[model samples]
Target: MESKSYLPKDHVDILPCMAAFAVVVETGSFVEASVRIGVTASAVSKQITKLENILSLRLIERTTRSLKVNAEGEQIYEYCKLVLESSANIFRVKDKLVDNPQGLVRMGVPKSLYATCSKLIPGFLSAYRDVNVQLVCGERFDFVTDSIDVGIIVTEKPPEGMVARRLFDVDFVLCSSASYISKVGLIAHPSELAAHSCIPFVGDLDKQYWKFRSSHENCDVPIPGRYLSDCPEAALTATISGVGVSCLPVCLAIDALRSNQLIKILPDWIYKGALQGTAWMVYQPGHHVSKRIKVLVQYVMADLSRLSTTWKLM
Candidate 1:
């Protein structure tokens, strides 16, 4: 098939405006496009208008209620996607010449990982002084369509169509404040948990059964709790205050365990099979991998490894 020709060489300077026009078409409004592109609505509108003028075509029919892309506009938008992507690749190539990894690296991580890694991220930025990192912390798996460069997720299986690298395996343990254990009595076995007041993670409680395995035996115990919360931090805080025993990621409960503020229950028993949680570093397979992304991934993997070891899960 013969390829359709684009505009004259002189029109190349309007590439940014053309890109903006494509975004507006896809988003159906200048305001939405502006939000996605991190630009003002007025600026996005002006750029789209400029592109329309350059092409001498009414690409979009705009009204107060809606914006519709014309046939020519749709074609241009399709071509512009390729053009903008190629242009971005050119800039990325040129950017690699700098000695330091420098650019914006947008990363998505689970809220729990964010809390633990917040302290370590600054060290990475210090090492690559030119790089600016944007960390979006959420529990939802929306990283792929959200344009996230890297996603740190805890899952048994990776999301479809993404490249996933195993970062680490996380272990969960039953933990309680030392004072609480001392006051209510120490829990030496899994069955003893039924008698203690427990703070269950509201999000996972419906899945209900907690499993444990020792050298010779395995058991899945039904868990009952007096309090429940969706936030891991809140649950940890409640456990720290001696409210109840909670099943927690060992990493998150480390400091309390070391200071004798929290005590682990049934140390011989393992939960959730061999893996309590699997941390996977995932990214879109064909997306551009900039130096900043490469460095950030390496740094995070190393940092998480160090943290995992410190938590005695190595």
Candidate 2:
């Protein structure tokens, strides 16, 4: 099969114009995007119009007082983000040599692991005195759209594209507060959970079926939860208050387990087949990796080695 070449023509001069169009669409108004780029609103409007003409399609729908990006424009905006960031990184590469491990390193981490991972950042900053780090800590994240330098995501599979550095296992633990277990008694089997109170986080998966696996067997317990949340903290708080049992990452529940604040259930069975099964460090493997980013990743990798082991619930 013959592969068709991309960029068969010359659009080099209009790349900046595309960027301008992107900003207007992203900011939802030419005025706001112009303020951001330090340009006149009319100039931004003109650039977008030029882009629309070149593409032979309407990118934005503008009323007297409002602006909206059409479907085509929204898709282009995403590409513009990648192109602009890649262009910016090229310049950042030149600055890397002199600065060494000094500059801003944008990182994304699950908010649930912040408490566990936050310790590494302070040590990294102290060692690289000139480097400053910014973190986007949250459950929901988008590396490309959000401009995340690196993202630590807990999932059974890494994202399909970009680049990924497999970090370690993120073993899920079926846990509850010690008080809750004392009242409800210990869960002996995965199937027994159906009769007990449970807390589940809401996501794309089948929420009613909680899965567990053993050396030779696997089971999906039809456990129901009255409390459903997107935040791990909410589930943790609920579990702590003796509300229900919730599956949590071992890293998030480490302190609780160590302090006897939380109790692990069905120790013989693995909290398997759920979405949160492993940890991966994901990023776009562009041509250049800044010195600061390299150093930070090194530090993280060294520290994260300890996290790979099958979690000890003690």
Candidate 3:
């Protein structure tokens, strides 16, 4: 780790010295080199002195008012020029990558959102052939720990220190198959659910409840059922098959509802429970986002905007 270990005690480092030496040679004057490097002329002169002392060679011949690189300095300057060109090329390649939408983007998506996000990714990849996507499916994710480039999160407000764009509100509707409703006989109030076969989502145990909100009041009805599942799509499937009544996101059931395959159980009441929030696309805040991530966010946001309109009609 110590550069001094490779040289004598009094000898200074080589890279900085070489850089200063090369600059002085190319500019032809210590003052001009110092200006280009944003340093004082004396500092540049000191670097050249340290470099000469380390090499045990006089690389420059200078007088009170004139300066010139000798034959030895000229030879070393050629290698220095190559080093400088290599450094410049490295930065140019980095700039090209940052400005181009071409790389793998890792995205974290909640499990239930598969029905929504799965539809958008293929089109994005088709439109930007050079870009690739890796979808990480889960209920929750830590962007830093998980190395997620962008993700969908459901919350009342966006998490702190993240750049977020609201996609839509996370809402659900109480629905079941028309055959199940006819078999059980239609009931008017939310309390009637207690007597019927009500479906509980995956984690519920002992007791399950459903919240209902109307213009005048809110109700919490106890849900009693024999079927349980974690996936929203599965819940919609079970409800469509007349297994029981379940609360499902409108995005997942809008098409079925439109086709009369499923009917809303409480049309006048909106389900207002744990699943309510504004779904947002969040990523780490930075001065410059990578082009791959930027394009993915833009594409997903636009697609979600169009999809949200259909949810309203349902």
- Please provide, for model 2 over 122-227, each residue's C-alpha lDDT reduced to its tens digit, 9 standing for 90 to 100: 9889899978888777755777688788878877777887687888776678888888877888778899888888888664164688887899899988877889
**Per-model TM-score versus the true fold:** 0.64, 0.61, 0.83
Question: Cα lDDT of all candidates, in order?
Answer: 0.78, 0.78, 0.83
Candidate 3 off by > 4 Å = 1-14, 25-42, 54-58, 63-79, 203-207
Candidate 2 TM-score over all chains jointly: 0.61
What's the lDDT for residue 267 in model 2?
Answer: 82
Clashing residue pairs in candidate 3 (N, C-alpha, C atoms within 3 angstroms): none
Error of 2 at 305 (Å): 1.7
* Model 2 lowest lDDT segment of ten: 1-10
True lDDT of residue 265, candidate 1 = 79
lDDT of 3 by residue, 93-205 (tens): 88878766798999988755777899999999999888999998775788989999999987887889999988888677788899998899886888888888877666322
Better of 1 and 2 by lDDT: 1
lDDT of 1 by residue, 1-314 (tens): 55436755657678888788877877888889999989999999899888888778888888898888888888888888876688789888786744457878788877556668777789998998889888887766576577788888888988988889998777677788888977988677887776778877755533366777899988877777788776667889999999988888777788888887788777777766323578899876765667778888899988888777787832
Winner of 1 and 3 under lDDT:
3
Residue pairs with colliding backbones in model 2 are none
- Which candidate number maximizes TM-score? 3
